[model samples]
Target chain A: DAGITQSPRYKITETGRQVTLMCHQTWSHSYMFWYRQDLGHGLRLIYYSAAADITDKGEVPDGYVVSRSKTENFPLTLESATRSQTSVYFCASSPVPYEQYFGPGTRLTVT
Target chain B: DQQVKQNSPSLSVQEGRISILNCDYTNSMFDYFLWYKKYPAEGPTFLISISSIKDKNEDGRFTVFLNKSAKHLSLHIVPSQPGDSAVYFCAASLKSGNTPLVFGKGTRLSVIA
Candidate 1:
């Protein structure tokens, strides 16, 4: 309850359907990030938020949308989930830029 | 292109021995480096970090060495135990806040007793 938490630990959705992955942090960190981990790729950042309303794209942002309306929540949305988007999603929160604490991760499967 | 590369997919080390994991980076702008340890189903936890100004940073049993000229870095675990077996990820950042980190594929360390 004191650290970051991710919702829907496991999910299976059809291609073309919209799916949202939720991330919540109790530390109220100023920086929050979303990353997807694949077999060959370790962790590619999808999006990051600096503050409540400031967000920016990372290495892999295509097809994924993120928003941070409040300091505690940063949600990632897949407008049209594709099979290629199937990967384990991770959410992290940091008080600064260097150190990060991650959630358990959400395993998303698209078919 | 991947800015950070961990080359080794996995490593095996005997218990009570030292385990060395290496990382290389292509970006010269990166000024900070960090190491993270991850379990099978858990997100990575921060292990150690070093700045460009210092070549080595040590904490407890974990130590990180950075070679700025070669754009290389390494994490060394002394007297590694079975509990130290996990996937280790290396990440680099250019600045603090807002900028996203570039991460390497990660190296899985297996400490066999």
Candidate 2:
């Protein structure tokens, strides 16, 4: 596929453990984002990166960590995951903020 | 506080009818609004969008109306089809740059045939 992609479509991990979700975009877009979808919360942004070396926190960034060392790849890591962190995680990219392209999403469950 | 809100959790519409999904935002700084559709196990795909400079934008069967004064926007699907059944989300952003989007809770639209 020529669009964005997420690895490990589904994941199960124990609380306090660490897990990382990968997002790759072939478009070489300068901007990338990590968002988690919960029942009533909709899609809350965890973090976003502008270019390869710059990153910023979003609405819910306390438990998640993200890095964009390369423009084509942005990875989200959950360090010492908690049960409340269980949700569907999506990665998106855009050359501009007007239109964003999303990956299939990763379903992460912390038990 | 949630910047973007979709109060309705779900909506049911009969096939061949019109389906309207509403969204509101608290941030007046948001200059762009967009709608996205998601299937059961898929990521959201962009549907349509309207800029703050314009009140309405249309593409085929989908039309997005923005009420700047009300700080609200809506997506209308005319003659809804079964294929339109999915979770629809409304999102907003400051502008088209490095900024990230703020999304609504999403409304599940079920088109019954």
Candidate 3:
């Protein structure tokens, strides 16, 4: 398609295991982001990438890791997954800064 | 601290009635506000947006109102439909084109038939 897409729409991993969530945008937007939606926290940003090889920590980034070696892909990695890390992860991209388009989402469950 | 907050967790409205969703922000630097609608198992989609320079912005049956002094904004849906029964999220940003947005929790709206 011509929009953003995410892989492993659903995942289940054990604690202490490594899991990676992939995000790709066909638009080649400069800015890409990862957000986790929780029951009470709403949508808390895990991390974001302004461009290729440029990534920054967002509101909540302790247990999560992200890398953007390419403009079209930004993947989030959980080096050591924890039970609390379970949540629906959303990948978003924006050509500019204000309006952002989101992908379907990846639901990850850590047991 | 939570910069943006959505107090209501869920709302129920009858079909053809008006659905009013409210949002509040504590950040003063945020000048741009946006509302997103999300359904089950899908990402949030953009619905409407309003800038600080204006008090209100309207699009079709959806309208957004901003109150700078009160540090609040609201999304009004006229003649709510069952299809509109989804989670609504309010987000804010600096409009500087550099910073990321701060999003509120979200409100689940159910348009009862």
lDDT of 3 by residue, A1-111 (tens): 799999999999999999999999999799999999999889998898888998899988998888888999999999999999999999999976677899999999999
Clashes of 1: 0
lDDT, candidate 1, B1-113, per-residue tens = 98999999999999999999999999998888999999998999989989899999999999999999899999999989999999999999886433567799999999999
Cα-based TM-score, every candidate:
0.97, 0.97, 0.98
| Candidate 2 lDDT, B9-99, residue by residue in tens | 9999999999999999999989999999999999999999899999999999999999999999999999899999999999998884536
What's the true lDDT of residue A88 in model 3? 96
Report the alpha-carbon TM-score of model 2 versus the true structure: 0.97
* CA deviation > 4 Å runs, candidate 3: none
Against the true structure, candidate 1 reaches a TM-score of: 0.97
Candidate structures ordered by DockQ, highest first: 3, 2, 1
Candidate 2 residue lDDT tens string, A42-98: 898889887898899989999888888899999999999999999999999999755
Tens-digit lDDT string for candidate 3 (B6-109): 99999999999999999999988898999999999999999999989999999999999999999999999998999999999999999885688889999999
lDDT of 2 at A70: 90
Fnat for model 2 comes to: 0.80
TM-score of chain B of each: 0.97, 0.97, 0.98
